[model samples]
Target: MVANDYQYILENMQKELETQAEKVGELTKERDNAGKKIGALEAQLSETKVVLDELELIGDDATIYKLLGPVLVKQERELALATIKNRKSHMETELKRCSQTVNDVSKKIAKEQDNLRDLHMKSQHVKQALMGAPQQ
Candidate 1:
């Protein structure tokens, strides 16, 4: 009887550990994606800033034959900033989700450890019972 119970507990613990590992793996992938997205957004913003700087350097537009597209240029900068903000928001949400998943994984690992402890205790109890049995 004790052997069967021990086997059952071991099987359950193995399953729980596998599940926790898979969750951690998924969280890692999601975090990597978020980081990549943030990097792309930052690069776009930097490029837009460079364009704006060039526009500023053309301070005396009247001296130039062609007009300076200040309005359209500012709009481009504004849109770039907005895009950066949106990407940052998305990254923040992804980070939060990853944090939650990590916490859940920790809890699950703890629970599995507790289950192992229970199985050990039950095995000991079963051994004691078998030993206490009288001869027929």
Candidate 2:
């Protein structure tokens, strides 16, 4: 009966550890994907800023052409500047949101790791004690 109980305890702990490990793996993947998104957004934001700077250098009356599906449509410089500004603003907001998600997931992963470590230690001790016990 005692051996059976110990076996049950170990099995439960093993299952719990597996579940925690899987969660950590998932969180790690999420963090990595968010990081990639952040990188892409930063690159795009940099490109847009460069265009915005160039647009600002142009005079108000200067003609701007917006490429739409291989066709260059004539656009006013002011309108072009406005569109770029809006895009930059939206990208900045999205970047912040992704950063926050990364931060939150990182914290959760840390906590889960600590829990897993503690559980592993406890399970090891339990196994050792069971081994030292006299067999029926």
Best by TM-score: 2
* C-alpha TM-score for every candidate: 0.46, 0.94
lDDT of 1 at 101: 62
Residue-level lDDT of model 2, residues 58-83, one tens digit each, is: 89878899999999999988789889
Name the top lDDT candidate.
2
Model 1 per-residue lDDT tens digits across residues 1-136:
4656656755665665566556556655665665566566566656656655554555443232222465322234444445546655665566566556656655665665566566556656655665665534
Give me candidate 2's TM-score against the actual structure. 0.94
lDDT of each: 0.56, 0.93
lDDT: worst 10-residue window of model 2: 1-10
